[model samples]
Target: MTSSDTSVGPSSDLSQNAENFNWLLSRFAGNTAGVRDAIAVSSDGLMIAQCIEGERADVDRLSAIVAGMTSLAGGVAGSYRLGTLNKVIVDMADGYLLISAIGCGSVMGVIASKQANLGQVAYEMTLFANRAGAALTPELIRELKNHIQV
Candidate 1:
């Protein structure tokens, strides 16, 4: 199976607590311009949750891709003794991709247009992800159970 097909179990109470995460991400997304997508992924390259409207962006594939890129960046940072990997940015022709390591294996990502205020977007996303981490831990367990049942 492709790496994107791999699944990470969700929390049993995810339905109850998911709103907390979604709310925070939504707020962040709203403040950023040209932000087309957002997603949460595990450090092991598994998709935990995603926020996309209209077209689907292949959360699993993107998660794996981001995880790999994050890992590589982390390794480079460690080599330079630059402390932890806080965030990464990839500037493309049309937009920018930003990823922030929340806690443990969780990461938050945002895709925004080239015109977006990267500094503001990064700051907001970081704050939101940090706050969401607490809510996500237990919720993840609950969602995992729910996913298993389904």
Candidate 2:
């Protein structure tokens, strides 16, 4: 695994959380070049916010896939004596999908282009996870769930 455990928790979503999420994600993308887009998902795999300008990605499908992958990665780590599941990076032919645990039950999923700086992207993702984790409380998750139809 090319990832390491990062100790950063979620942030507060009790306030104008959506905007905060967007800002944090935007700043994250800006700080790291080559980030095509990013999404904030609950630990259970529900999309809370997206920080892209163009047509949105299929949140439902991506959420499910990311959640499943994250769980699988955790299982693999546990079975292999891997310390902790910091993040999961899938290097595709054209791009990368980076998933990192935000807090207890949420994750931040990022999609970066092939030209993207993967190392920096991964580092920034951990940063996002740490900050976003605080915003993923049960109440906030429930709140985010209410906003989504599925």
Candidate 3:
């Protein structure tokens, strides 16, 4: 899917941590030209936060997709002793799905347009992971999990 013009901010009632995550995700998706949506998921496949320009259902589906993909990739890496799984990129005919680790067994997923510069998107994703990684501690993850409803 391509970019959308609609803009939405994080909800006011979100906890500070969740709000920060939403803000980070929003910045990543909004500032990146070809990004369509983004979501953060826990290792247990729970959606923690999202920055979507369209329907919430779509982002929820994306959360599940990315989590499943990450699990599969991790399984393959472990089976082949290829070391830790870093990222997975699904390049489709119309767009791309990019998933990257965000530390503490959490991940961030991005949906980008067909015209997106993969190199740029990957670089920005790396930056996002680095920025959000340290903050994803166990307690914060639990808090986010409790508050965010997928």
Candidate 4:
């Protein structure tokens, strides 16, 4: 994972928050047994933060996938008169891709191995979202967008 360049932005608070977000995501992936990678993306598909063992291109691809999945799910929910789109789980042969809303117009995407405990990972994702959602304001998102790691 690429560290946020604190010196690149003007607001220390934003920088600190970005760092905190990165740390939180790192912990979520590290502490969870089945989790392989995770990312936090804005409503418009911008990557706010990521915690993955791959290159930047991987992060970008995940961001796009998350955005598309959420959009399609939301559409489905509306079409079927579902109250709200909560989560979308894609169970692949090797692993799973789970996308869930984290509030404040953002969503969290997690990739977990096939052997991972799905229930446990879902619980952890909820915890992480609740803790990080409030801090994901528009201003911080803008700052994060401007200085996201390449």
Q: Is candidate 2 or candidate 3 better by lDDT?
A: 3
Q: What digit string (tens of lDDT, one per residue) describes model 1 on residues 1-150?
A: 123332222344456566555556656665566777777776666666665553234655566678888888889998999988788999999998899987666788778888888888888877876788766674563463345334
Among all candidates shown, the one with the greatest TM-score: 3
Better of 3 and 4 by TM-score: 3
> Residue 51 in model 3: shift from native, Å?
0.9
Candidate 1 segments whose C-alpha is farther than 4 A from its true place: 1-15, 54-57, 138-150
- Writing each residue's lDDT as its tens digit, candidate 2 over 30-59 gives 567888667767766667765544433455
Predicted structure 1, TM vs. truth: 0.76
Kindly report which residue stretches of model 4 are placed more than 4 angstroms away from their true locations once superposed: 1-14
* lDDT of every model, 2 decimals: 0.68, 0.69, 0.82, 0.81
TM-score of each: 0.76, 0.75, 0.88, 0.87
* 38-131 per-residue lDDT for model 3 (tens digits): 8889999998777776676776788889999999999999999998768899999999999999889999888899999999999999988888
Which residue ranges in model 2 land beyond 4 Å of their true spot?
1-14, 52-57
Model 2 lDDT, residue 40, Cα: 69
Per lDDT, the best of the predicted structures is: 3
